[model samples]
Target: MYQLAPNIELLFTEAGDYHDRVRAAAAAGFSSVEMWGPTGVDAPSTPKDLPALKAALEETGTTLEAQLAEPRTQFMIPPWDHSEFFRKLDEGVEIARELGTPRIVVGSGTGFGGWKRQVQLDKLIEIYQKAIAQIDGSGVTLVLEPVNVRVDHPGSLLDRTSEAVYVARGVDSPSFGVLYDIYHSAVEGEDMRAELAGAGDLIRYVQLADAPGRGEPGAGSIDWVERLGWLRASGYDGPIGLEYYPTIESAASVRHIVEVAARA
Candidate 1:
């Protein structure tokens, strides 16, 4: 959470491959950059095969901020598949260990068909609680983000920071918490400043993108400075993950993001 070492995935336009985009981020003066989970490894980021990737990170001075993770396929359409669920969780933990990444995101996926609503919710909560324990003290936190169900992530379990906050409270462990994404809040018609101000404690990481286009902060209607000012004011001394797809070059938007959010 140290000022969100920038993630290069956002800058990936239709222009080039992910590797080239990462190189571009390094050239643009970022000391540390974030790469996607499975994409971090050259071909496959297995335990035995990650040394080369480590070399690459050492070479570029880029660190893995957090991974989007392998998705919730097992939980997505569950006949309540605990077997597949725990298996992927184990794999994800191994992958995180290999990458030296401190964070991995886990999603509480949609209905497993024919299950009652409360049943699904309880199941999800139970699974996440166990998952939290599985990754305990691994130097990694399984960050659960709240998305905008109205548009992008329909049927998403963790759709509000409040909900995420609740889950974090239930799990009640340092290994589990919420990764607050600002763009989703804006789209959901939340007062960005107020939300963070109220629940900053439960949040472990914070990301930004402006609504309407999920682009850079200043590019959209979000008052980047004012909102970020609140974070600093509220004692959020963590990385503010820049998970935006700028309508321009990736590095081109960094300075603007920093400057604008600096209240400059």
Candidate 2:
């Protein structure tokens, strides 16, 4: 069975703070959870009490599947300066170490206006290669995410799974790979099987939500069984983060996917 790590930022909100959400998710019988940023540098994701969050994880025996890299890297603009992103990476990795998180989700922010798409993609290769070198042997893998331009993230540079796969290939490091978000892919209308086949082993992490609405699995048109089957066929044996807004209570929101994923 595939392990499902609910996004504490969106799920279990009734439990109070971030640390309390961890305990709440564990109480709901989830063994793992995922979250947004650690230091709250990114908006919509408040700063977390790292020590308290770590204690809660330990107390519940829950694994932190992943966390977002701070200061979202928007590389394509004219005055492109990535100093802060590089500087804070060590801090992000340290927080990950404290929480025992193995993967950090990185993104290619809004498109660099006036730059050719191919050139922008190549630039990502250079950036991540340096990042991998910096974080080498840290035991923290950086998973590049391609957000959809259609619904959630407009004008984002990396929106296609194939492009993310290309960047991963260019980086060519064991420490870097792709994070295939099912909701984003579905929103972009990519063929699930074809994309997964193209991605192959480079897909180091996965996340899901119903497309058209970005709600819990059952709230959209995606065929959970078929999608999960394609994921299984692609040989991805990793945790699938429940990164969606809950339309109902937290526990009730997960029931559909839990039942469907059990057999998947």
Model 2: per-residue Cα lDDT over 166-198, one tens digit each: 999999999999999999999999998999999
Model 2 residue pairs with clashes:
76-112
Please, what is the whole-model Cα lDDT of each candidate in the order they appear?
Answer: 0.67, 0.93
| Reference-based TM-score, model 1 | 0.84
User: Which ranges of candidate 2 are over 4 A from the true structure?
Assistant: none
Report how far off residue 219 is in candidate 2 (Å).
Answer: 0.8
Those runs of model 1 whose alpha carbons end farther than 4 Å from true positions after fitting are 12-20, 39-52, 73-76, 111-120, 262-264
Clashes of each: 6, 1
Kindly list the per-residue Cα lDDT of model 1 for residues 1-264, writing each as its tens digit: 234456655664433555455556666655455555553332232222356556656678766667655644337563555676576667777877777677877666664566775576566668778887776777878888778888777877657677667667777787887888888888888876677766768777778787788877678887777777767777777766778777776666677776665452
Number of clashing pairs, model 2?
1
* TM-score leader: 2
